[model samples]
Target: MSRSPCLLLLCLSLALPCMADEAKPGHMVYLRAVDPGIVQDIRYASAHNFTGHPLDGYQAPECLLSVDAAKALARVQTALNAEGYGLKVFDCYRPVRAVADMGRFANEPGDPLKTEFYPRVDKQDFWRLGYVARVSNHSRGNTVDLTLTGPDALPADTWTPSAHPVDCTAPYGQRWHDGALDMGTGFDCFDERAHTDSALINATAKANRQRLNGAMEKEGFSGYSAEWWHFTYSANTQKPDVMDFPITPLAP
Candidate 1:
């Protein structure tokens, strides 16, 4: 029952596209596929995160977001590029397993990254203080953690845990340099200084935060009050369902 060579070639061509479409479901799309201009740091996929180790379910350092959210983010990228600024995403479409892992790490009775990420907050109080949660808006795929970066944004600074650790409350430049615009505090800084409208930050940091908020808001995304870098798209047709899919690289 072998098909002719021409027939087999036609069948293969028809099936390839379908297989590729099935590979990545319609709900979640790799952000780079939708908008290559967006920068991605994807901290959970690397040891540079608060856990001091890579989190679960991050098979690749890629940003995955719900289809609608991805489209909205692409629009935001377009708007920011015009202003000579760019968006650098730290996290997007977090997995349920990763959120659960965060809970476990928070309760594991250790503070390996405390000085870098949560200087003022105790690990045991992470859930109580609204830092880590059993469920996350990120799991729903509409939320994103991001910051602004200019053409001259710096790269992440080298850190050695054995050295006297710098407090998360340290001045932006003095602490970890994430190559992003000085937004008062580094990402995952569990302190009042990371608040979206914190008055203690310098003028430049305040302006940078405001600019980020404004740009995100213009694209119909709302900022979280506690974490200035957090935002969720609000124009979605339906409420997002929590997802636990592992983030893997998309097929070429």
Candidate 2:
């Protein structure tokens, strides 16, 4: 027998929410499409990251962010550009599987890039120390990891699998040259010195950090205390869910 009209309506209503949930992360767009001026140095797509290898699902070295976040970041870039500074992104729109891969890397024994990325910290303590999150906001499509670039910043060096590692917490010029202004430490430094308000850093580093923080904060991004490069776009009204879609290459 056919179902009653009321029952049919209830069933249809129940399915609607599930159908709506599937449409999330669809708003994700290439950051360059919005602002090519925002330099990208996506580490997770290469072997330069803490893992010493490209993370899973990062098929391309591109930055992806929600539409709102991208536009807001573009505004920040424009503001900074007027001051002779621009944003250099390290990572963006991380996939859910990449987060899982990071967890697994921390749980395992090897630490090939330990000397540079986490010399003072143990891999197993990454999650407990707040250096790495099992569920990153980047998977939600609004968080970004970036730094500032200016005239004084050194040119970015080409990273290869065989390059020797340097201490990430060392002084600005002593660390790897990532074509970014001094922000106390290098990207992905898992030490306390990488903290946004760490006292160990010199005055120059502190000033740069404050400058970057102020710029990003003005654009609706909030910096994570543990890592200065980390920021989440809070101005967006859309509530995005975690996504595992592969990071694919953008069209040329």
Which number leads on lDDT? 2
Candidate 2 to truth, TM: 0.89
Cα lDDT tens digits for candidate 2, 159-215: 877888999988877789999998889999999999899999999889999999999
Score candidate 1 by TM-score against the native: 0.86
RMSD of 2: 7.5
* TM-score (all chains, Cα) for each model: 0.86, 0.89
lDDT of each: 0.81, 0.85
Q: Candidate 1, 146: how far from true, in Å?
A: 0.2
Candidate 2, which segments miss by more than 4 Å at Cα?
1-25
Clashing pairs in 2: none
lDDT of 1 by residue, 1-252 (tens): 233344334335543211111234577888999999998888898877789878877889999988888999999889889989989999998876687689779878777777788877788888888889867889788999999998656786654545456666687667778788889888888999999999988998899998899989988899988999999999887876666667888778
lDDT of 2 at 188: 95
Which residue pairs collide, candidate 1? none
Q: Largest TM-score belongs to which candidate?
A: 2
